[model samples]
Target: MATYNKRGYKPKTQKEKEEVVETDSATAEVFSSLDEGANKTEEWVSENQNIILIVVGVLVAIALGSWAYQVFRVEPRAEEALVESAQANEYYLQAVNATGEQQDSLYNMALEDSNGKYGLIKIAENYSGTPSGNIANYQAGMAYLNLGGANYQNAIDYLTAYDGDGSILEAYAAGGIGDALVQVDQKADAVSYYLKAADIQSNEFTTPKYLLKAAQAALDTGDNSTAVSSLERIEEEYPDAPEASTAKVLLAQAQIAD
Candidate 1:
């Protein structure tokens, strides 16, 4: 129950206490003098409570107005975006359902969903700035790759431009580049991207697969020494990975080849 002064950690002396009492008495006298000019808290509050209510109401209105405005602009745009994206997804699915050369029709449909709305390519081009557009690039890249595994160059191009926040998706893109390179006989390049994909560390399933692919690329390029090293890494680092079987087999093969 001890109060300290500003200068030191001690209570006020009697003189300071007396000074505080005098200050309170003087302040009381000043408040009394102002009583006749205004009804004080009671009158001021009564007179201005409606004004206060109106001010608060205006503030609430502003907050709600801002929220409504943002929703009006953002929601409709996002909805339109979803519509276009869904159409693209539908086209992709259609392509999946189709077989033989008829799949081109499905690809075109995806690009020109009966509504003449933005196709996947255009969605990728226009909304290239948005998350949806980035996904469009991913889908389009995959479509191209699937349609022409020989078009690995183009697949690598689009996959390179892809910007996904997901580590797994990014890893997939990297692996796609490796696959495309391998298709073109760029085994060394394939190994690089495959190694990068395997290093993504996003999921259990994809990492081992990529690591195996990297090791294989090394082997195919007559780098059995490096291939052996990579296989050993997968065996030791990802023993539980699905690629473990392949890694062991590759390790044995590399040892034999070496």
Candidate 2:
């Protein structure tokens, strides 16, 4: 029969006072549990910090040993592989300039061993952790692309594996993957990569170009709204970029279509 928020109401009897004390006792139990847990945590940390430091020191020493091994042992092996790969690199450069059977021979030489030197695959295999190995991946992927045998998926695989950080070349690499995906009839996936490339920090050379391609792909897929949005972003965010002049025009056309 009591209404809510009847603040002036009183308990019917004196024993009702104990009911408030019971609620207060429950709250105190919660606070006690929290204090108990905090003390346990502090004690555990105090007891184990020395052991933790020793473990960390041992881990640091092991990591240093691994680095030393790489510097002394692995790097020398990679250097040897680089020397062994020189003939293959030369043949690849030659293949770039050749045609007919001469080109075929150079291509073959680039892929196969000659005079005890390693082919591209061998250099990649032996020096996989080295910078030269990563470059070999690019070189090999390009060679495969030039040869009529490369599938677009293979191009994407190599391009996505690019580990270069914070450079316009990485953006270009991402765009290359997008292009390869487009070549394989995967325009939707290509658009994602193109957008990713466009989102990276860039200047007049790459950012707007990739964004335009992404917007065009969006339009082809009946995503006119998204296409317009991307074009508008290009016009707004990159007014000085080469594609921006065209982007402004394209954005106007998209709005007309809308």
Candidate 3:
């Protein structure tokens, strides 16, 4: 038929009319598919309304419970732990920084504060799940270690209980346990712990230091194989570390002993 164009009135060609019809059909098909999809979605929703509602209710309950737990339990406990830890932390610092008998005295005070409300042992015992408590475990372990005598086992126990983020503190805890084990005559386990400390985060400083310790422990146990291995690891992985030179000398000695 005839069609009016922007330029002028003109008769529609058969091809042009066919093209227009095809375009309309394609548009209609797209709309039909969309409508079908919408209808199916509505049908599914209607069919599974109870299930969907139950799922949503469960999700909402979980969210609310999580929020309530954090607010009512976690936050308050953390705050109290932090407050107690502040005093404990001061004592711990004093213990670590002091000298001679004063250091040991401060360490004892930190382990068993006079007030009894803020001490590493108390915090670790009472608030074992708190962050401050976790730190308390490490502090207590180190305190026991510094006290030396019969506290080596205590150091091992408390340090073994510590769980820290993958930080230098974790390395220190592992290394502390290794030292304690060595003192307790657990040569083999001490070697294992020293290697663990060196590998935990694998930094140039802690790794090489612990590796050197591992080598020494191995040598002490007459395990020339492990001594060589640890020393070689230090030379290969931490060649520029301060322990590297020492590690090389140790490796030479261990080789001769082997």
Q: Evaluated with TM-score, which candidate comes out highest?
A: 3
**Residue by residue across 1-258, what tens digits does model 3's lDDT show?**
335333454437887667667766998999999999999999999999999999999999999999999999988998899998787789889888899999999899899866757688989998888898899999999999999999999999999999977878999999999999998899889999999998889888899999999999999999999999999998888899999999999999999999
Q: Candidates 1 and 3: which is better by TM-score?
A: 3
For model 1, residues 1-258, the per-residue Cα lDDT tens digits are 224334454336887677667766998989887885567777888989999999999999999999997688656666667777987898888897888877877876775546767778888777655667777877777777777745566677778889865568899998988888888889998998888887776456787788788888999998898788878988887899878988998899999998
lDDT tens digits by residue: candidate 2, 1-258:
333215765556556556656656998999999999999999998999999899999999999999999899888977876777778889899998998778767866786667877787677766777776766666565555555345566656666665657577678777877778777778888888888888775666688899998888777776778779889878878877888877787777778777
Model 3: residues with Cα > 4 Å off, grouped in runs: 1-37, 236-245
The order of the candidates by TM-score, greatest first, is: 3, 1, 2
**What's the CA RMSD of model 2 in angstroms?**
10.9
For TM-score, candidate 2 versus 3, the one ahead is 3
Tell me the lDDT of candidate 3: 0.91
User: Which regions of candidate 2 fall more than 4 Å away from where they truly are?
Assistant: 1-64, 87-115, 146-150
**Model 2, 62: alpha-carbon shift in Å?**
1.4
- The better candidate by lDDT, 2 or 3, is 3
Please give the lDDT score at residue 84 for candidate 3.
83
* Model 1 lDDT on a 0 to 1 scale: 0.79
